[model samples]
Target chain A: NAGVTQTPKFRVLKTGQSMTLLCAQDMNHEYMYWYRQDPGMGLRLIHYSVGEGTTAKGEVPDGYNVSRLKKQNFLLGLESAAPSQTSVYFCATRQGGAKNIQYFGAGTRLSVL
Target chain B: QQQVKQSPQSLIVQKGGIPIINCAYENTAFDYFPWYQQFPGKGPALLIAIRPDVSEKKEGRFTISFNKSAKQFSLHIMDSQPGDSATYFCAAENSGGGADGLTFGKGTHLIIQP
Candidate 1:
C-alpha cells in the first residue's frame, strides 16, 4: 500500500546548507507529521499539518519548517542545516476519525557536517 | 519538558526471558498510549496500544499493561528471541488525535541475547 513514503533515504549536508525532505502518503489521511529521531532522544516532533494548507509547530520546531500544500504530501525544510540538526527524520500520517494509530515511513538519515 | 518518561534506557535478557519497558506521563489528558518498535535503520512501527478504559491489551506475545490512575504504562515481551532486539518507544496522545502528534518517551534499547 505504500502507506507513507519518504524520499532521499540518506543525505549529507554541509553546515548552513538548506534542504527539504519529502513525505507522501496515499492513505488520504487528514493529519501528517514530521519528526526527528536522535540517540537517547527518541522522536521529537518537528512540525505538523492538520489538513491541506495548514501547518503548526511542534516541540522541536526551532530549525525546521513544513509545508502541506497538498493532502497527500508534507515537506520538511531546513533553512540552514547545522551539525546539531543531524538525525533520522520520519514522516507519519493517521486516518481521520476516532482511530489514532499512526503509520510511519522508512525514514531519512541526514548528516550535517 | 518531557511529557512521557520511559525507564531502563537499555536492557539485555536471555532468549526466552521476559523484558518489560515502562513509561509514565504527566499529562492527565492523554487517553491513548502506544508502543513502537524500530530496527537499526527503520522507522518506528506500532507494536501494540491501549486506552485508558482498559488496563491491559494483548496481541500475540506482546502486551500492554496500563494504569490510568498512575498515568503509567508498560510493554511486556514474552518468550523473547534474538530477533526481537531493537529499540522500543512509548508514546501518548490526548483526545487531540493525530493532528496533535504524539509525545514520546526517550526509548528503550532491548537486546535479547542468543
Candidate 2:
C-alpha cells in the first residue's frame, strides 16, 4: 500500500543549494513528521504537521521548512544546504488519536558538500 | 537536556543469547514507550511497545519491560538470531498530548554473532 514513500532516495548538493524532499502516504494518516538520523544520534524531529495546513517546529527546526499542503503529502525544504545538514532523512505518519504508532519511509540520504 | 537516554551504544551477543537494551526517561509524564528496529538502508520499524499501566509485554521473541515508578523501560530479545542484528531505538511520548511527536534516544547497535 506504499504506507510511506520518499522521493530522491539519494541527493548531493553544494553549499547554499536548495532542495526539497517529498513524502507521500496512502494510509490516510492525520499526522506526519520529518526526522534526521546521524551516526551515534537517534532520529531527531525537525518538523511535524498534525493535519493538512498545520505545521509546527520540533526539537530541531532550524535550516529547514515544511509544508503539508495535502492530507497525504508532506514536503521538507532546505533553503540553504550545508555540510552539517548532511544526514539521512526519514518521513513518518501516524493515525489520529493519542499514542498512535508511526510508520516511516525507507529514507533519503543527502550529502551536502 | 535529553529526555530519553539509552545506554550501551553497541552490543555483541552470540546466537541464542538474549540481548537487553535499556532506556530511561527524565519526564514522568511520558506514558507511552516503544522500541524500534532499523536495518541498514531502511527505516526504523516498531518492534514492541509498552504502556505505564503494564509491567511487561511480549510478542514473539521481543519483550518490553516497563517500570513506571522508576521512569525506565527496557527491550529484551529472547533467543536472538543473526537476523535480529540491527540498530534499536527507544522512544517516549506523552500520548495524552496527541499532537506531540516522539522523543527518541541515541539508538543501540546490536550484533548477533552467528
Candidate 3:
C-alpha cells in the first residue's frame, strides 16, 4: 500500500490566491490530520478528520477549510493565501485511537507571496 | 499552540556517544508517548513509542524512557552514528482511544559526527 501521500510537492502562490492541497491514504485509517511546519517550529495541526464526512478544527485552522469526501482523501484549501502560510505542510493518518501507529506523507512546501 | 514542551533545541555528539532528547507535557490525560525522526527533505518517521503504564521501552539502538508521575519522557540514541543525525520530535496523546492523536514537542536537531 502507498500508506499516505500528498499532492503538489511544492507550490508558489500570490496573496488572495486560493488553492487546495490533497492528502490521500490507503490504510483505511479513520483519523487523518494536516499540519504545517515552519522553521524552528514543530508541526501544528491545521485540520483533522475523524472519519469520512466528519472534520474538526485543530490548533491552527484559520484561513483553511477541509473536506473529507471519501475515507481515502482529505483536502486542505487556502481561501486567500498569505505570507504567514509559507511553510512545509505534512499529512498523516493513523489506524484509530492511541494504540494505532501513525503514518506520514513526504510533505508539500508552499510559498505564499 | 503547543501542549508538549521539549528542550535542547539542538545537539551534537560523537560517534559511539549517547544522545538524549527530553520532552514534557501539561495534559495529564496524555498516556501514549511516541518519538518521530525526520531527515532533510523527508517526512518524519516513527522511531519509537511508549505508554504511561511502562517506564521504559527499547528497540535496538533507540530507547524511550517514560515517567508517568513526572509527566515526562525522553528518547535516547546509543552508539550514535552520523546516519542517525536528524530531527527528533517527542509527542504525547491522552489515554482513550480517541484523544490518542499526538501533540508534538517543538523538536530537537541532533548531529552525530563520525
Candidate 4:
C-alpha cells in the first residue's frame, strides 16, 4: 500500500505564478502536515490539519495555504508564487492512535525564478 | 532564538565509526524527540524516535540517547556506512500539548566516507 505520495515531483514558476501541490495518504491517518525544507533549514511547518475540514497555521504559514478536503488528501497552494518561496515541499501524516510517527511523501521541489 | 538547536552543521566520519549528532531544546513541554533522514531529492523519513521518559532506544544501527534534565538529546549511528551519507534532522514536539506541529532544527549534514 502506498503511504504518502506528492504530485508534481518538480516545478519551476515565475515570480507571480501560482500552483498547487497535492498529497495523498492511504493509511487513513487523521493528522496531515505540510512542510518546506530549505538548504540549511531542516524543515519548517507550513500548515497542518488535525482532521478533515480543519486547518491550522504553522510556524511558516505565510505565502502558503492548505486544505484537507478529504481524509486521505491534503493540498498545498501558492496563490502568487514569490522568488523567496522557492524550496522543496513535503507532506506527512501521523496515524490516529500513535505517540507520533510521521510518514512522509517523496517531495516536490519548487523553484520560483 | 530557535526552539530547537542542532550542532555540528556538517560532519564526516569513516565507515564503522560512530557519528553523533546533538540537539537541544528550550521548552520542557516537548516530550518527544525524533530524528529524520533525508537523501537528495527525497523527503525526510523518520529514522528513530524516543520519549523523554526513556533514556535511550535503539533499532538496528541507529540509536537515540536522551537526557531529560539537560533538555538535550543525541542520535548515535553505530557502524556508520557510506549508505548513511545524507542529512540528519532532529525535531521536537509535545505529545500532549504545544502547537501540535513539529519544531525542527537547522539540521546536520553527515557524510560517511569509505
Give the candidate number with the greatest TM-score.
2
lDDT leader: 2
Worst 10 residues of 4 chain A by lDDT: A94-103
lDDT tens digits, residue span A8-82, model 2? 899999999999999999999999999999999899999999999999999899999999999999999999999
Between prediction 1 and prediction 4, the one with superior TM-score is 1
How high is the TM-score of chain A in model 4? 0.96
Predicted candidate 3 versus true structure: per-residue lDDT over B34-107, tens digit per residue:
89999998888889989787889999999998887788899999989999999999988765745327888989
Each prediction's TM-score against the native? 0.96, 0.98, 0.96, 0.95
DockQ, in order, for the candidates?
A: 0.71, 0.73, 0.60, 0.62
Docking class of 2: medium
Tens-digit per-residue lDDT, B1-114, candidate 1: 899999999999999999999999999989889899988878889999898999999999999999888889999999999999999999999866446767999999999999
The lDDT values for all models are 0.92, 0.93, 0.89, 0.90
Please write out the lDDT profile of model 1 over residues A1-113, one tens digit for every residue: 16899999999999999999999999999999999999999899889888999999888899898999999999999999999999999999987767788899999999999
Better of 1 and 3 by TM-score: 1
Where is model 1 chain B poorest over a 10-residue stretch in terms of lDDT?
A: B93-102
Better of 1 and 3 by lDDT: 1
Model 4: how far residue A53 lies from native, Å? 0.7
TM-scores (chain A) of the candidates: 0.97, 0.97, 0.95, 0.96
What's the candidate order when arranged by decreasing lDDT? 2, 1, 4, 3
Q: If both were scored by DockQ, which would come out higher, candidate 1 or candidate 3?
A: 1
